[model samples]
Target: MTATTLHADLLGRQDPQMADVLAGEARRQAGTLQLIAAENFTSPAVLAALGSALVNKYAEGYPGSRYHGGCEYADLAERIATERACALFAAEHANVQPHSGSAAVLAAYAALLRPGDTVLAMGLPYGGHLTHGSPANFSGRWFDFVGYGVDAETGLIDYDEVQQLARAHRPKAVVCGSIAYPRHPEYSAFREIADEVGAYLIADAAHPIGLVAGGAAPSPLPYADVVCATTHKVLRGPRGGMLLCGAELAERIDRAVFPFSQGGAQMNSIAAKAVAFGEAATPAFGSYAHKVVANARTLAGALADQGFAITTGGTDTHLITADPAPLGVDGRAARQRLAAAGMVLDTCALPYGDQRGVRLGTAAVTTQGMGEDEMHRIAVLFGRALREEPSRTRTEVTELALQFPPYGQ
Candidate 1:
């Protein structure tokens, strides 16, 4: 049966309430812009895998070493997922069991570090993820985290300062990644600094791993001692996480993920991740990945033309951080106005100031077949949405979104 029929007829037959919620969400997604950097449209095949019978399985341990019985299919699914992840990222080992990106990072830390160990990563105000070292996060409580910030003038990572920090702090690990930097990190520089200070280089590549998979970004596999990534985002998989490392760290990483951090693999998500990896390996995905970046560049320039202060001038990847102060609004107010106008995005920490900036990406729109011209239109809409009445702007935004339905008509 068709997707609509399955959702409405079958699901509505039993759980009409939840089905209505699901249907409403689907309508909402199709009826509004999804500019969130960390969101994407997974393929129908991937969605099917997520809804597959594998969801019933509960394989507690790794493939061929389960804690429970009747795990043959689960083993096969996990094995395939692990193999595809390793091949897709060019890593010697892969663990496809972490439930989220944070879990993967937790497992990485558990495998390599003890409580109270010193670590270094990007500062929160500089676009670092919460797991990096937020006072509210476990990373800050369990480990002494020394943050490294970007250059105030360039809005880029201060590699020299990073080196200085590493030498002085002598951290056990140095993480190289950010949530809103809008640039590819100098992995080699990080590796060299880590080596100099005898620290392991951990690449929290949750944002860029999909681009790396599609050959749109540089791979951190060659430099990082361990790489933690989300299977979703631009990867277009089910919500999950994975870890990659050399063979020497495989067992340690696996044990950390299984016994220490989590239990019972989500076989369905694992299966879906395999599907996404398989898709990412194709030339079509490579083209899509490049288009994602191209669209973001176009959108950044367009937004800049509309008076938003584009951070770092423009973006090199799917993400863009822009200050809406030129539009007479702060990031929080801008986000509310945009939401009222049917455009969805987030506010992020600005590198130099306490003021927040809007963070957006082209992955979802590009997946819906939007191009450079559409990017320009979206920017125009941004200006009108901020300056004009919300009702009028919302009508145009809905019309634009309907024209590019994320799912087939």
Candidate 2:
């Protein structure tokens, strides 16, 4: 059945209050711009899998070796998910059990290092994820972390600094990934640095994994010893995480995800992830992925024209990080104004300073069938929202969003 039919006939009939909440959220998503770098619209097939009976299963272990009984179908779903993930990413082994990207990173750490072991990763201020060793996170409390920063002038990863840090610290693991960096990571450089220091190369590929699937970004599979990723974002999958590794580490990775970090796997989410993986493997998805990057470049250029200082000058991926300071608003204030105008996004750290910048992506908009033209128009809306009354811009934003319904009426 269609989404509208499901909401009205089943959820609306059973629990009007909860249905109203969901309906409101649906309306908000449909009517507003979703420029959030990590958000996307999952396909109906993926949504169907997420709502399936597999959600009821409590499969606690790997396929064919479950702790609980009556997990045959659950086993099949996980197997298919793993197979597809492996094939798509060209990894020797795939583990599709981690609940989220952070969880996947945790599992990778559990499999590779012990408490107090030193790690080298991008600095949080430079776009590194929390799992990269934020003081508030478990990783920081347990492991000693050395951070690398980007070039102040170029907003690009400073490979020379990374190598120096790796040599000085001799960390147990070298993490390569970021939350807001808009360019493809030089995985080979990271690999070489890790090798020189006798460190394990861990790729926290949460954001770029989708682009990698679509052939729009380089794969970390060949360079990193462990690749951790989210299934959603530009992949258009359900919110979940997975791990890829060589055959030698497969058993350790599985154990880390199952008995160590997570208990029962979410079978329904796994099924949904499998469906997304299947969809991503198609030629159409490849075209869509490339367009995501193209739209982002267009958006970045347009935002620049509107006076936002685009990070890295432009994007090689779907994400774009820009400072709105030139428009007389900081990232936080800019996000608030944009939200009022019905445009949504996030704030991120700037490469060279204590101030933050705005982070946005083209994945959701492109998924809504918006092209480069829409990106340019969206940039114009951004200028209006920050300069004019938000209420006035809100009307125009909603009208534009409604033109390209994420799901058809």
Candidate 3:
């Protein structure tokens, strides 16, 4: 049967309950703009592969092998995914399991270090994710986590201070990545620091994987001993984590991901990952990455022009963190106002102060076909909402979003 007929037949069989839920979600996505730094919408092709028949399989092992029956097709799907991920990231190995970004970080840590080993990580309030070493997280509980904060004067990472801390702490690994950080870390500097302290370097490019793959940002594959990321964020794939490492450490990484960290892999997600990798390999994806960066910068500048303090001065990637105090508002107030205005972003607290900030990104809207103009316009709407009543701004923002509805609805 043809592909179109197959889709029609499948939709014909959808139950009333599921159909209503799906339709409501479609309407919600179509009517709003997603500005969260950690979120992105996947392509329809990726979605199709995610919900395909491959989910029925019980493949409990790596490709070309399985512990259960009926894995011939599953093996092919996973092998294709593995090869494509390796090629896209130019890594010696890629483990497409881990289920989530947090899982990937946990497994990489489990494989690379022993319990109670000292770990140097970015401070949570300074843009580092919870998995990096928030006291409430497993990483902090299992490991001796020492946090490094951004320079107070500039609000950027202080590598000299980091080196000093690494030398003092002699950590087992130095973890680098952020959810709200706008600038890229100097990986070479970090490598040198790690080497100086006899520590391993773990680069979590979960937020910028797509930009790195398209050459819009620096690739950490060479400098990092192991790299971990989420496929959903900038890569715009299914919700999954990937562990990439050099050939020498491939075995340990794979073992840690499988028997040590998780059970049977999500074959459907792996298949979608392969599709996402194939999509990211094209030249247009390069353009898309570039646009994401440009849109972020544009949005940052627009907000700054409205008197908001753009964190780290401006954005060098697809995200920006900004203080909302200039508009006589707090991060929570701004986030709520934006949500009511048909836009969504996150509110975050700064490390050492009562001040709060909002994180904005371009991945989702850019994936929905927005460019610099739309991003700037959205920033204006955000500014007006923060400065005025949310009800006044909600009407106009809703009108703006209607111009480019979500795809596939």
Query: What does candidate 3's lDDT look like per residue over 130-168, in tens digits?
Result: 888877989978999888999886889999889989999
Alpha-carbon shift of residue 241 in model 1 (angstroms): 0.4
As a whole number from 0 to 100, the lDDT of residue 229 in candidate 3 is: 93
The list of candidate 3 runs beyond 4 A from truth reads 1-14
Which ten residues in a row are the worst by lDDT in model 1?
Answer: 1-10
Q: State model 1's lDDT.
A: 0.93
Please give the lDDT score at residue 12 for candidate 1: 88
Write the residue-wise lDDT of candidate 2 on 1-409 in tens digits: 4334545456887898888887778888889999999999999899889999998999999889998999889999999999999999999999999999999999999999999999999989999999888999999999999999999899999899999999899999999999999999999999999999899999999999999999999999999999999999999999989999999999999989989999999999999999999999999999999999999999999999999999999999999999999999999999999999999999999987777889999999999999999999999999999998889999999999999888887
Best by lDDT: 2
Clashing pairs in 2: none
TM-score of 1: 0.98
Question: How much lDDT does each candidate structure score?
Answer: 0.93, 0.94, 0.86
The TM-scores, one per candidate, come to 0.98, 0.99, 0.96
Ranking by TM-score: 2, 1, 3
Tens digit of per-residue lDDT, candidate 1, span 180-279 = 9999999999999999999999999999888998899999999999999999999989999999999999999999998999989899999999999999
Error of 3 at 401 (Å): 1.6
